[model samples]
Target: MTGVSLGFIPEPLLVALDHILPSRRLPSTVFDSRKFRQIKASIEEIGLIEPLSVTAMDQATGNYVLLDGHVRLLVMQNLGLVDAVCLVATDDESYTYNNRLNRLSTIQEHIMICRAVDRGISPERLAKALAIDITSILKKLSLLKGICTEAAELLGDRQFSSDLSRVLRKMKPTRQVECVELMVAANNVTVAYAEALLVATPVARLVEGKKPARLAGISPEQMARMESEMGNLQAQYRLVEQTYGQDVLNLVLAKGYLAKLLENESVTRHLQQHYPDLLTEFGVVVETVSLDRRHFAETT
Candidate 1:
């Protein structure tokens, strides 16, 4: 097999701030944003951790087009920095570097924090660098303490509140996995949803067989009803999940057939004259670009 091509050069180059040109303009309000503040604070506390991604130098001007790290560039400029390390990309296109980025998930963040602490980085120093409280840093360091391997793996690529792990920790490993799967399937992995799942969990499924605390304004009867409803929902979700692939295949086949059928002049004319609504509906199905849930809902 052929080797994969590298987008940027392996070694970073020291480029002057004046030699790097931003690809886009930043709004004035960006300076006051929380993200910008955090990035600035991080840079101030520990210096720039990530190098600026730039295109190959233009020999005419002896400058590089800044592909990524515009905010960092602005921060360094505000701090009166003259030079920065830059990664020189092979191509000038910034789409892949800018738009097609994978953000760190909550679990991934936790793992990195743990690794950093293990590598002798103090929680206080990390909190300062991240512009967060030391307590928050400690909380992130212990994010996966009671979470099961399976549940943690399920949430590896997902971004959710660190507090969600607190709710999962109350349940047994099997129940944690089940609840995580349910939350993932429903695409609602918030702390609130996790708490609801905790409430619906059977006492036996909880750690130490303890009952889930009653939520305020909800009586035992209402809680029981919620549990029953949650069970039914999970059952239905599993049933749908099992058949989702086959359903998609059938829809694709049907869409292709309808598209071909609508292509014939005689058939299109007959449908227009006798069954205009059906023809319109068929046209919608044929025109759908993807088999995603949103598209399916819109078509239906």
Candidate 2:
């Protein structure tokens, strides 16, 4: 199929609020949601950074259909706004904007906050605009102060907690990168994981050359064992990272082949008659992308 162009002339226009009809219904509890409150606060503070997307209803009707920004429009209506700056879409399709939405990652959010501060936005004002505390704004401003470049890049698009950055700052750059790689491989960036990584870090890899404090009920020997195992895990994680893309491609091809093989009438009958157990396992794999039951199926 050929690609079709979308959007109206690629320019923003000032539209009367009455002309735009919202296509989606806002939940009654939306005003109580933290996200909605933030949207309202941000609009009140900065006056709508992202314009609503709309498409002209008719050539002579002087009306438009709201394609995106349902929440923004609701907030504006509550605020008694008479007009809005909107992007007039050429096509009426709103799926791309509504369903394929991408929120800013932790690092991207940090960068944006830094940019805004550099442009003379005060921490207090920014905090109010985001409906967050002033301390949170300060924490975000200093989020990447001690993170290694490689690890920062690895986590740039991940929605990890900012507190993890604080935990990472205690490790040496090399160990930080290793822990980050392990986290990425496991697809977990929780503070608990970061704390575990910190605990397993060798004293030499610590920024101040001091060992992590031992947890209650855990002896030094156990910590030593954990550090050793963590080192081995890092080695294995690096090996997997080296061929991750190729491994995924192979897995996909194998699954597709297996699915096709199981689709054949003869093979299905043979399996059902002579290898019912194996057939059940194969059916599960064909239906799901999980690697959970086989040797590759274990959780991190």
Candidate 3:
């Protein structure tokens, strides 16, 4: 068996800030951004949590090229830091360092906070370290308190508010999963959409089997109508989902056939003379990219 190759040195090296050269220049506006301010505050409060990633030192100048953590580097410079720890990469390719990066999702943040708290970190300390309010940290800590495992897993990578989870908590586990699936499918995972789903939910599907409170302008009749319509919409969506793969396959085959047919001069002339509209439509199907055609099929 072959050993797996490592990108960075196992041990981090302490390097002077002056000797670390940034691979790319950041925009001037970035210095004034909220993200920059948060990082600066976090470092000021607790110190840098993640070390910078840098390429191996150049023998000529004894300088290391920074592969990642530009914001942290700038923050350290602003804070008058002289020396910092950096992981030295085996190669100078910054693209691999950045391209593989994953932003923290809401659930991932929750898990991190929970882990830190379990390690005896207080909410106040966490808030200061994250440069957010203590309430926000507490909210993240309890983000999945009432969420079912299936729904939470479905929304694991999604960034949504605690209020959305609260809304989900009002429904039974099955309803929660359904609502989450609907919201994710529509790409509208906002609290508003979640609330709309909650409103349309049948009373039996609610957590306590209680009816949802009516909105100011919506009466019982209106809510009932919405419930029926939403159920129909969900059914239609699932039906489409079931057939989407086969539909795309059929369209691909049809497009390929039409493309080859259009290549023949005789067939093209026959369509152009007697059925110009049909020829134009055929040309569209033959020329349209798969993604655009898929979108058209879904919309129609």
Model 3 CA lDDT for position 235: 93
lDDT of 2 by residue, 241-267 (tens): 789789878877778888889889999
RMSD per model, one decimal: 3.6, 4.1, 4.4
Off by over 4 Å in 2: 1-9, 25-36, 94-96, 212-217, 288-300
- TM-score rank order: 1, 2, 3
What TM-score quantifies how close candidate 3 is to the native fold?
0.81
Native-referenced Cα lDDT, model 1: 0.87
CA-lDDT, candidates in order? 0.87, 0.85, 0.88
TM-score of 1: 0.86
Local accuracy of candidate 3 as per-residue lDDT tens digits, 78-124: 89999898989987676637654567888998998899899998989
Per-residue lDDT tens digits for candidate 1, residues 54-144, read 9999999999999999999999999999999998998767653865356789988998889888889789888988888898998898899
Candidate 3: C-alpha lDDT = 0.88
